[model samples]
Target chain A: MDQPRVGLFVTCLVDLFRPVIGFSAVALLERAGCQVEVPTDQTCCGQPAYNAGDLKNSRSIAQSVIRAFEDFDYIVAPSGSCAGMLRAHYPDLFKDDPEWSPRANHLAQRTHELISFLVDIRGMASVENVGFEAQATYHDSCSGLRELGVKAQPRRLLATVEGLDLNELPGAETCCGFGGTFCIKYPDISNRMVADKTADITATGADLLLAGDLGCLMNMAGKLKREGSTTQARHVAEVLAGMTEGPAIGEPEKAPGT
Target chain B: MKPQSHLFKENAKKALNDANLARALNNMKAGFQDKRRATIAKLPEFQDLRDQARDLKNHTLENLDFYLSRFEDRVTEKGGHVHWARTPAEAREAVLEICRSVDAKTVTKGKSMVTEEIGLNDFLIESGLTPIETDLGEYIIQLRHELPSHIIAPAIHLNKEDVAETFRENHTQLDPNRRLDQVQDFTDEARAILRQKFQSADVGITGANFLIAETGSTVIVTNEGNGDLTQVLPKVHIVVASIEKTIPTLEDSATILRVLARSATGQEYSTYTTFSTGPRRPGDLDGPEQFHVVILDNGRSALLGTEAQDTLRCIRCGACMNHCPVYGSVGGHAYGWVVPGPIGAALDPGLIGLEEAHDLPNASTFCGKCAEVCPMKIPLPKIMHHWRVKEHEAKLSPPRFRQGLAMWAWFARRPRLYRLGANAAIGMLGRLGAKRGRFAKLPLAGGWTAHRDLPAPSRGTFQQQWARHKRSQAPSSS
Candidate 1:
């Protein structure tokens, strides 16, 4: 079979906050026998606009995204929240438009979150020759867990790792309250929720915490740092690609030994 | 009842600071979720049943006017009267008229959220009638002059010790030092007090879980059997229910009931799934002498063909709230309305107007757990989004928020500019926080900084790094 050409939709959060996750995703896809390209025209997934109920801007942003990545055999994102925006919500944005609706629907069909695409579509059983020796737990970002059904794909890949002990976080599927603008809009409620989430994360006693979506990862990592807990947070893609040499998310920019 | 939904943020903060309420909410969070999960896992056909229930509700809602008329006709045929109420005022007036016809004095209520919506208890009290709540939770909250914090579990925000205090203050005749330490003790005390109110009441009002058009029956499902006594012992039984509660047939009610109990409190079936069709008939041993059904629209009719129509399919299971992290954190009273949690967040804006209920739809994290657990399969997050659209359109959101969104969207549409801007912003942030890797505080980000440190970005944007990496990778080949 010909190698599938995949367009990388490095989400806005990952693009700005942690580009390493983007690189990690490319490494995983290539290792799984796929050619990957990060389209230059891609910027954001229009999720901020879409979530804020700004449909007019969400449509224009989505149109730009469609035009940029429509030619690829597949489109994948490291974040499920952005991938869900492209795959699940983009079509609804143009449902009534005769011209853009079909194009949006077609793009949505080809879109996938990185881990689910790696496991379900690409039929990649597990990461080969990759090992991370640490006790870690995974938090299921809401969109990835519910909208994209990405519950076990990450675990399936992590199981192949030689020395990773995956202790499941309590309420792993609960939201960490990094709801784009929700944290700012209702900060108190969001704080209460993320506080509980941090409590649960610390209780797991895992040194490292992992999740697919960068937004949730950053939120949890920030809270953990504020609480002065030693548990580190990182995107799951980084661990899967055996790219844990650098600092974990929200940590000083230096290798541990150095 | 007066709709403090506008103060949602303030209410949520107050609820968070409440230590006793926090303890109560934590207990509820663990109890309801585990029970629902365990009950749902045991039933293989649960998912299919949920689909069927959703379809059934969709069908009935599409033909709501017709089924409602059929319900009225069936009730009339069985010597019962059905009154149509377009607003809460009209519904309250209709109930008052029925009570007046029977010269009612003391009225017993059996956990009717619709009555709360219509402000029936306060209205009755002001109009010289005594209204007594019979449901244990409802009774507790009523004595405290509070609204139902949760729809199904009225006093869920109260711990047992809080209840003991409330009972000690109100039940003045009880032995002052009687041991009310245990759960059974509280229930026994409530039962003894409510029994007299049940016997002396001239009228009883209850909410219908399902109103069957086929048999003119109104169903009430409860664990305490208080509703059975509330309706059966009264001379006049008035069921206050919204028009959306109507179903075409008794069998349709059965289909919904299968999911309702499993979704609510995780029972195979509520202890008493009692159905009352009409007034007492000849030779009937125990039943109401007069039966009146007040079918209320109260802003629901406007949702028939709109984006929020799916919310009308809600069975009030409380599963959404049970699984909701926000609801679990702040508890239900913070929603500041009759129905709370996801259902209130989605439906309240439509009922109470977006300007007043704007904060509700915005309070959620869009976790979609509510939609996932909804037995009716209502897209609750989607409905909330619809309200957000309306809120934005009305310019109800703070101008600062809208301006920030506009600025973000404007920059995002231009890929090159967005890349450059992001690169510049991230570079600055990355440099400032390189030593610590996170910011303890940041300007214009107090909301985030107040609770958690903001993680600084990597040194540069991904697009910039990707472009440079690509050039290096193909240095000689290209």
Candidate 2:
């Protein structure tokens, strides 16, 4: 079989806050023997605009996105959320633009959230079991589990990791309630939910709280720090790709001078 | 008043983002909810009661036509009129006819979602009759010219400050300086304002929680006692409800109530549980002189045999709404329906037609909290999935979405092509994003990447890594 020409849609979370995941994606892809290319002009999948009801901006961005990767053999994301958004909301954005439908359809078909891309498409039932392990609990990010069908991909990938002890948290799928702007908008309610999620994570006694999306991790980690909990938060990609020896996933470091 | 169904998001956004509104919602987390829980906890037989209640409701639903007729029989026997309304228009007409028959100028109403469903207050006012909502929450929302966001807590989105503002704007005569104070103070003030309306009203209208067939009685549960006043004070008391509410016996209804308070507010029962079979009895001191029960079908019967038929199993406990993360964030207004929560998600498609409400089903995170809290154990997420399937089948989803899924479905079936396709994806992404190691925008991905980052596809898909592991596995095993 010919080596596949792959395009990684490294999510903004990894690019801006968690760069190790992006490097992990590249290293992992190289290990898999696929030619990896990061398209330079790529921006975002316009989820904030789409979710915020600014369809015009969303369409404008989607057009740019479609143009950038339209030539790719396949488009993959480390994020189940970004991949889901690309696959799910892209067509809706271009529904009225008659010429763009096929292009959008082609892109959506090739798009994959990393783990789902692994388990469902690649049939990767096992992965390099590098001795990087932890007793960690997994969180099902809303878009990942529901929209992108990433429920078992992360689990399967994690299972293949040599020393990783995967434990189940009760109510694993409940939103940490960090719905992007929803956290800032409903802080009290969001705080309550995040605290509940933190309590669940702490209850597991898992050294690491692992998830696919950084949005939930950041929101949860912030709450944990504010509440002074010792549990560390990491992304599922970081875990599966064996790249967790980094700053607590997404939080920016305290500067030299403030 | 403003045709709220059309501008749902604007209203919901206003409600959701408002810190004042969130503060107002805090009362709900504690007050009605805590009280309800306390009452339910005090009752040991609550689960047994819920089981009986579910069975009772099942029986009523199965024999709805019979129980409804039986209710009609008892109403007629008590010298009250029974109006069978197959639609909202018919129900509205039945109400207008009664108003015109009595030349009613003023109407006092208990908290009733059915009346809201038919736009009764708006219709009555349009027909030139004055209608007032006696339930404090309903009254607050009415004054705000808004729809109730909750079945039980209609003004749940409004804080006490908002209420104080509304009261100050509407009822100016009272010394407005008195802190607008406690809930009791607010209720007392609201009572004084509504007492005269109740006493002088030409008619009273209430929604029936349950209609008992054996005794031909209509039951209403309330915490504030306003439903009783709305039923008792006027010259005529008109009961507006859908056909699904009737049961064969009061004992059956009591069973349902066991779960109702607990699931809704965590209460064993509301403070006031009134059963008004008809108008005032001859010996009754204070009750309406006439009674009328108006049963509205309103597209519910069409749902009877459909896949959505199990949706009727909902008992309006509000637990689904209370536990829904989406509803908790967006509030009920965004659903653009009277019932807005998990129950609202499933029921709205059937009631309003799938096209208008396709967004409702898709709005859920599918956290399954609603199904968990649902006393009936309704599989809300599965039902939502069914709606998505139906949406896809109807070609209601954009053609591009279909083409995308259809293509994925294609590759998904063919394992080799899928693996090649997958490897090709991660390889290309890794190459393009080699510099920054992440692409913020991609051809079609910018729709999402524009707002959020797209973490570059990692080096080879997990399948390639698995292959290496397999080759390595032979060495380890040997």
Candidate 3:
């Protein structure tokens, strides 16, 4: 059988902030016996516009995304927010456009967030964990957990990791306050919320924090770094795909003399 | 009540810094949320009940005029007077007229959010009638001269110490040195103080949890029996309810009641689920002689056929706020309205003009937890999004935000320009923070950097890297 063609929707956050997550997703997809193609025309899932209520531009961006990745057997994104944007919101975005609504729905049906795709769609029992030895806790991104129902898939895969001791953050399913534009719009409240989140994360006494969405990971990593906490943060894919050699997100480079 | 929703950001900051409110909110965050989870877990049929409740509310909303008329008719037939109020002012006047007709000196309230919405208490006070709050939380807040932060838990923003202080200040008859340390002590104090008010009040005004058209009944669920005493003790009983509270049948009300208490306080049933139908019948042992139902539309009719129609299904269980992270962080005062949390975020804008309550919708992170836990399954985030669109269209959002979105959308629509822009931005960001791996501050992103650092970008965009990798691997793969 031909390998099912998957178009990697490398979300804008991952594209700009952390490309390794995108590569890690590609590696995991390939390892699961799937052929992945990167669609360069993919800029963003238009969540920023869509979320900000700019429907006109959201629709245009949705149309571009549909035109870019519609031919692939599956459209997969590393971030739940972006994937959820495609799978859940894209249909609604084009609800009025007779020409685009059906196209949006077609693409939505084929879209999946990366981990859920591996566990639910690909039916991969477990991935070969590349021996990431750390006490790591997973923060469930709000979009992924609530929007995509991605609670157990990542954990199910993580259970097979050779040396990963998974300590569940108390409010693991609670939001990390990286609500796209929300963090900027309501920074004070967002900061308080992330402070609560970081407190919960530190309470677990885990050395590392992991989440599926780069937006959330970046947000958490930034908070952890700002507070001068030693706990590192990374995308769940990097650990699962054995690409953990590089410094964790937001970790400063060592001085040349040092 | 004048809306302070425009000051939501400032209010939220103040709430975050309030240590007392933080303690109260933190307690609520765990107690209510966990108990709700536990109770829902015990009931397998909860989800089915939710669906039924949603459908029932949807059906009633669709035929709202029919159900409302039926309710009014049944109420009138059963020796009750029904007054229709198109707005909050009208509702206030209707209540005042009822009180004046009875020559009421004191009006006792039974935790009515609708009354709060209509500013009924203050209106009555201004009209020269004293209003007393019978519910303990309401009584505490009334004494404090503050608003009810949480809907179900009115004084939820107040700690026990705050309540003790409030009681010491208000109840001058009681000894100041009395021990008011325990939760029960606070309740007992409120119970003692409000008991006199409930008895002395000439008229009682209560909000309806559900107005049953089948039986012409106004239902209120409370942990304390204050709602019953407030209505039964008073000579004139007035039920102040919004129009959307009307349900088709008693059975539908029962189905909704099954989820209401469980969702609100995590109890299988509240201590009191009082269903009052019209005035007392002839030869009744103990009941009010006059029963008045003031049905307030107050801008709800405008949302009947709109995308936000789902908001009308809200049972006001407050499970949404109980689970809302934003609400948890800021408590309810920051919302600066009768209703707070996700429900307020969506509904307040519709009730008050969007211009006044615009900030409420944008305050959310669109986390979807509120919608997830809502027994009505009202798509709260979706409703909030609708308001956002309206705000954007009206140019009510900050001009900088609009221009930023416009600029980003311009590039987003064009892939080539987007990639080029992304490439240039990523290169600059990567080089700027290459050593630190993050920026402590950045131009035009103070909102982000004010709280946390922004992680620096990689050297190149993912698309560029993928393209180069693909080019290098083409011959090897073949």
Best by lDDT: 1
Candidate 3 lDDT, B120-227, residue by residue in tens: 878888889999988888888888888899899998888877888888888899998899999999888888878888889899989999999989999999989999
- By TM-score: ranked, best first: 1, 3, 2
State in Å the error of residue A168, model 3: 0.7
Q: Candidate 1 lDDT, tens digit per residue, B1-478?
A: 6999888888889999999899999999889999998999999999999999999899999999899999999999999999999999999999999999889999999998899998999999999999999999999999999888898999999999989999999999989999988889999999999999999999999999999999999999999999999999999999999999999999999999999989999888999999998999999998999999999999999999999999999989899998888998888888888889999999999998888898889888898999999999999999999998888788898899999999999999999888778888898998898778889999998999999999988777777777877878842110
Model 1 lDDT, residue A82, Cα: 93
Cα lDDT of model 1 by residue, A182-232, tens digit = 999888888888899999988989999999999998889989999999999
Model 2 spans > 4 angstroms off: A1-173, A176-208, A211-232, A235-258, B1-19, B22-49, B431-443, B446-452, B474-478
The 0-to-1 C-alpha lDDT of every candidate, in the order given, reads 0.91, 0.73, 0.90
Which of 2 and 3 is ahead in lDDT? 3
Q: Write down the TM-score of model 3's second chain.
A: 0.97
TM-score of 3: 0.98
